[model samples]
Target: MFVSKLFGGRASDTFITRNSGLISHLIPGDQVLADRGFTITDVLPPGVTLAIPAFTRGCKELPEHEVTRTRRLANVRIHVERAIRRLKGFKILSNIIPGRIQHVDDIVTICAGLCNLQPQLIREEIEGKASDLDEDEHIDEQQEGDEYSWDMAEDIEGNHLF
Candidate 1:
């Protein structure tokens, strides 16, 4: 899931419309929870449910189709809020960012990857993932097999060996 801050109005709308071309991967029941910022007026791709808040500028009464779309998107939007809270768990992100806005894009991506790598959040699911580990352990395990892997080739403190 990604949230990019594009220019307001048509630019923002265009960015969302184009990027959602990847919606083919999403199956029915899979949902997209977006902020009011991502509220799109047009139809979305099939099988990708969207949950966006009401568009303030539009009339108070939304047509049936619009109401259904907004509700579907809202159900997913709650999860996006949860995700944002989780990301803010890291001090670097929570604190005022120091650099130019241009740098934020890379920082956000790197932070997301790091967050995804963290095991603490997976503690409850780690046991369930044991079977998953076994399936690809030959290629993915570090301490067990894959000594030549990039991860194992470096120290925890990132001291380079080669």
Candidate 2:
């Protein structure tokens, strides 16, 4: 779901508080694909999964498994980034809508709606790449016992050493 409400540059972790209403709508086991900036896992509805890239802290490189997972995530996430780009394409949002502008919120919402109606931002070429990665994911799932995908809080699960 696309959110067009203006949140004036608060930390991404504050997303839970900002979008509290959204939480009630989420069902258990829902998969939320987000970037590393979203660190509000604690506030997520129970059983809701948050998928983000693996962090490479202290280590020179991420594990081979992590690298593959990250690649798969990036393949899906590019579309989200492109959609944001489309929203920002509107001049009002690309530049600052002045405080004096009447109904600025409505204008922003309208722009977002219009942007959504436009064709998918990413071209068809990458669609095949995403599908190919999906097939690889099935193969990986069969090979790896339980490590199906990248989860931001995997470390907190107390299974991974690094």
Candidate 2 wrongly placed segments (more than 4 Å)? 10-20, 95-102, 122-162
Task: Summarize candidate 1's per-residue lDDT along 66-133 as a digit string, tens digits.
Answer: 65545543333333344455556666666545754566656666666664454332123332212233
Residue 23, model 1, lDDT: 48
TM-score of 1: 0.40
Global lDDT of each model?
0.42, 0.53
> After superposition on all CA atoms, what RMSD does each candidate show versus the true structure?
14.5, 10.4
> Residue by residue across 26-102, what tens digits does model 2's lDDT show?
66655566667776677777877777789898899999878877776665564455555556767776656577366
